[model samples]
Each structure stands twice: as structure tokens, then as C-alpha cells.
Target: MKNRAILIILSLLLFIIVTPSQAQTYQTGSYQTGVGIRMGNTGGISVKHFMDGRHAVEGILSARWGGIGVTGLMEWHKEAFRTEGLNFYYGFGGHLYLGRYQRYRRNYYYESRGAIGIDGILGLEYHLPRAPITGSLDWKPAINLIGRTGYHEGGLALTVRYTF
Candidate 1:
């Protein structure tokens, strides 16, 4: 009986010492905003600003199809109910395209197009338990509101950022 009581007391003391240390190691930040360059054939500089705790606004300036384009986006983020260290986000936005394209016949086609439409994003982000690095993957779908009439585009991207 005395041995069992000693063992229980030791276990309780160990739990009391370790619990606070584990809780203290979970570090999170707020209102993260950043800008960075994307690497790809259709890549650009992107900026994202977080609003409140679960919403964000984003903008991108990219070159595509020999034209320069700009996009505006809004996103909402939520913590995954059953997962730790995971967040899911979604949102919408618009874009404008400018510049020119060359036809197969060697003719030059100049375009000054503007598109205003909705965007949907589904993504998962993981924040390192006490670290400043965040990693994410997301899919974005956008619909064109101007030239091409009923054109739409969808893409997936990976993101990494350092939180402050």
C-alpha cells in the first residue's frame, strides 16, 4: 500500500511539472500581414493582410498569356474542429488584364481587359508549435467578368511565410 501511494504521488508531481511546460510552448501570433514574390511562369508579387482573427484580404500582380494582370481577393479562415495545428480558409476576388497577345497567324492582338468576379479558396495551413514558420496549400478558382465573356480559371498554390 505504501509503495502504491508513493508511485501515485510521484505521477501526480510529474504531471504537475510537465503540464505547464507543454502549455507554455504553444505560441501563436495575431494580425499577420506580409508580401512576397511567387516563383512560376505566371508568378507575381502577393500581399496578404489578416483581419480580425479569421479573415484576410489579398492582392496579386501577375503576368499571364503575355499580359499583365492584377487580382484582389478576400478570404476567411477557420480552425479545423478535429485537428490540432491546422487551419482552413476560403474567399473571393477579382482581376484586371492588360497588354497584348500574338495570334498563330503572326498577327498582334492588343487587349485591355478588366474582369470583376468571385473567387473561392480552400486551403490548409499548419503553424509550427512555437516556431515562426507557417506552411500552407490552397486552391483558388476565379471567373472572368470581361473579355472571353464566360472564361474561368482555377489554380493551386503552396505558400510559406514567417509570422511576426
Candidate 2:
């Protein structure tokens, strides 16, 4: 199942990479919103909405360990190099997570009922020209302030969004 899932994700990435078109994207100030899937250690559905040319907010909803996680973010976008449809973004946000079992790398485990954390995100995004689609690779590191207090770093993800 895991291999099949990875294959599907890779195929989607290839599809996004091959097709290019012209469109006003997030950095160009003409795009309004994007909604898609977030694939990562903690992932589900993701939605991003631009407030202006460079500022945007994103929300993610995911289920894990018999519970749910909700995250919100405020981000800034800037053109990367002279590449059309390519941009770099960074942001900070917060999350509320609920779980039944949490693992530790040191060979221990515990049950975590809930927690709140601050999250930071850095990513590169590409808007497919002529297609209402965009793809991004990101790292979102987070530190829990309430429950299961610690830092998490393996938050790398690939997001494919359909924009309007």
C-alpha cells in the first residue's frame, strides 16, 4: 500500500512538471486561492488564499493516530530568480493536534491526548503556466508548547494545488 501511494504521488508530480502554461499566479498578484492535498508526515487537505501579491494564508486539516490536526499559517511569497511561475515562500503559524499514540525516536512511546504548537514553513512553489495548478515543496518545522513538548523537523511535504 505504501509503495502504491508513493507511486501515485510521483506520477502526479511528473504530470505537474511536464505541463506549463500562462497564468497570473500568487506572486503576480492575480491569483486568489488554491486548494489541494498536502503530502507529508502530517498531511491531509490544504487551502491557500492570497491576500495580495506577496501575502497569503494557508490552512491544513489532517487525521492522525485516531485523532485530528488543524493548522493555520500566514505566508509571504517572492519571485525566485527570473523564473516565471516560480517563487519562494516562508511563513509561521500554529497548530492544534490530537492523537492517541505518539512515538519517540529514542525507543519510547506515549499517548498524547492533545497539544498546541507554533509552526514555521519555508518552501519553493511553481505555478504551471496556462494551467490553474501549482506545485510546492516545503519544510514545516514545529515546536509543541503545550503537550508532548519537543521539536519536530521532518515536516517536509509536497503540495499540489488547483488555483482560481
Candidate 3:
């Protein structure tokens, strides 16, 4: 458990340090809606819909702490490092974490717990220009404000979707 957390933290740091910030390239989202799956510490069903070329809203429903968590985010997307089909995005949102069991493990406890929190997302996405597919790798962090209060360094996630 500790190893996984360490690895995740290191990976995030590496990406942040390495991503080039030169005036490279970017493209507006070509697809309007993408529905897919997310795999990570909070893996679940994911859906993203673009309101325009650069703005999008994403929703995630996942199982966490023996309960359910729903997250909604509003994001802005831009081209990344002159790479075609590659985009960099960042966003913020809120989440609801609901648990209904006495779960105690690894310095964590959630007994019928429900909390509200805010979240931030950072990542890169690649859309296939010739296919209706898209993939993204992102890091999400959250802080609970209502129930379980803490700064959660959200895990790294890979999301794949069918775009339309």
C-alpha cells in the first residue's frame, strides 16, 4: 500500500517536471461526447462532454471506502507541446463520498460516512484522428470539507473512451 502511494506520487512529480511548456501546439476537442472507463485508485464509469472546443464537463462514479463516490468537474483543454492529437487539461470540481459501513483499515475509518470535497485534475489526452477513440492519463487530488477531512493526493488514472 505504501509502495503504491509512493510510486504514484513519484510518477506525478516526474510528469510535472518533464512536461515541456514551450509554445508548442494544441487543438480543440474534435468529439463532442466521450463515455468510457477510468482505472486507478477510484476506478469507475466516466463520461465527458464538451460544451465547446475548449470547455468540458466530466462525471465519475466510483466505489470508494466501501461506498460510492460521485465527482463532477469542469475542465479547460488545450493543445500540448506541438503534439498532434495530444492535449493538456486542468480543472476543478466537487465530489460526494458516501459510505454506509464500519470500514477501518490502513489508518482510515469510514462508518456510515458521507462527505463533500473539492477536486483538482491535471492530465494529458490523446485523441485518434482516424478513430472514435480517446485516451487520457491524469492525476486527481481532493480535500474533504464536510466529513472525512484531509488532503488526498488522488491517484494517477488512465481513461479510455469511445468518442462521438
Candidate 4:
């Protein structure tokens, strides 16, 4: 737990330090960085950064039914219809689930282990041109490839983030 905290902190520091230097390389929709919470079937922390006008990356740390999971994604974005500030994005990523879960049924008990999975996302985002807030609605589907292998379908999220 302690080591995980340190690694998360270090990663955020590196993102903050490295982002600005690469900022001038490309144009962005609204703000270059955004951080906030997401609500859906699961609750999580979300951070997104636009490396350029059409390319972005996102990271999520989620608390779910079985355990905690972390996901990373690389995305491509394009303008949505003729709407200003509205964009649609598609991405592919992966997740790592950690922690153990146990179910008790009278005298019988079952335990489940953590798993690693692949993730795909499709979403619509609106970055308000005059405000520091960005709102998005997205669907993420995941398929477990390790541990207990299966497909997970409930991965919709609504997010409101402060951009800078």
C-alpha cells in the first residue's frame, strides 16, 4: 500500500513536469489537462491530458464490486458534427485489478482472485470554451484475460472535470 502511494505520487509529478514542455508542440481543444471524479456503475478518479489536438491519454483508478483497478488509455479525438466544443473519442486500454474478494453463503464460502484485463472506450466530451469545466459521458467495456477470465459490461461513466 505504501509503495503504491509513492508510485502514484511519482507518476503524477512526472506528468506535471513533463506535460508543459511538450505543450507547445500541438494545438488543443480547450485545456490541456483535466482531473475529476467519475460516477456510474463504479466510482473512480479520472485524469486526462491532451498531447495534441487529436491525441490524448487518460488514467482512471476505480473502486468496484471485486476490488480496486487502475486503467490507462490512448485516445483519438475528432469534432462531433458541427458542434463547437463537442468531440467524440475512441480508445483502447488495459486494467489491473487488485485485492481479494470473498462471498459467504451460510457455511459455504467462495473466494475470488484479482485479474488483468483489456479495456475499450467510446465517449463524447464537451470542453466549454469559456469555462474551466469539461463534461463527458462514456462507455467502457472490459474483458478479463487473466485470473478469472470473463467479460464485464457495466462501465458507463459521467464525468465533470476542472480543466487547466
TM-scores for all predictions: 0.65, 0.78, 0.79, 0.77
Model 3: residues with Cα > 4 Å off, grouped in runs:
1-26, 101-112
TM-score of 1: 0.65
Kindly indicate the candidate among 2 and 3 with the higher TM-score: 3
lDDT of 1: 0.61
Model 1 misses residue 1 by how many Å? 74
Question: Which regions of candidate 2 deviate over 4 angstroms?
Answer: 1-26, 102-109
Greater TM-score among 1 and 2 belongs to 2
Clashing pairs in 4: none
Candidate 3: clashing pairs of residues? 25-82, 26-79
lDDT for each residue of candidate 4 in 107-148, tens digit (9 for 90 to 100): 988666788988777789998888999999988877788865
Best candidate according to TM-score = 3
Q: Write the per-residue lDDT of candidate 1 for residues 43-160, one digit (tens) a residue.
A: 5777777765666787878887767888788876666554566776666577777755444534755444444455555568777677766666776655555664443435667766
Predict model 2's lDDT versus the native: 0.80
Residue 53 lDDT, candidate 2, scale 0-100: 81
lDDT of 3 by residue, 2-64 (tens): 457646655764675466644334445579899999999868999999887778999999997
CA shift of 136, model 1, Å:
1.8
Q: Which stretches of candidate 4 lie over 4 Å from their true place?
A: 1-28, 104-109
Once fitted onto the true fold, the runs of candidate 1 whose alpha carbons sit more than 4 angstroms away are: 1-31, 39-42, 104-116
Considering TM-score, which of the candidate structures 3 and 4 is the better prediction for this target? 3
Clashing pairs in 2: 21-129, 21-130, 22-129, 22-130
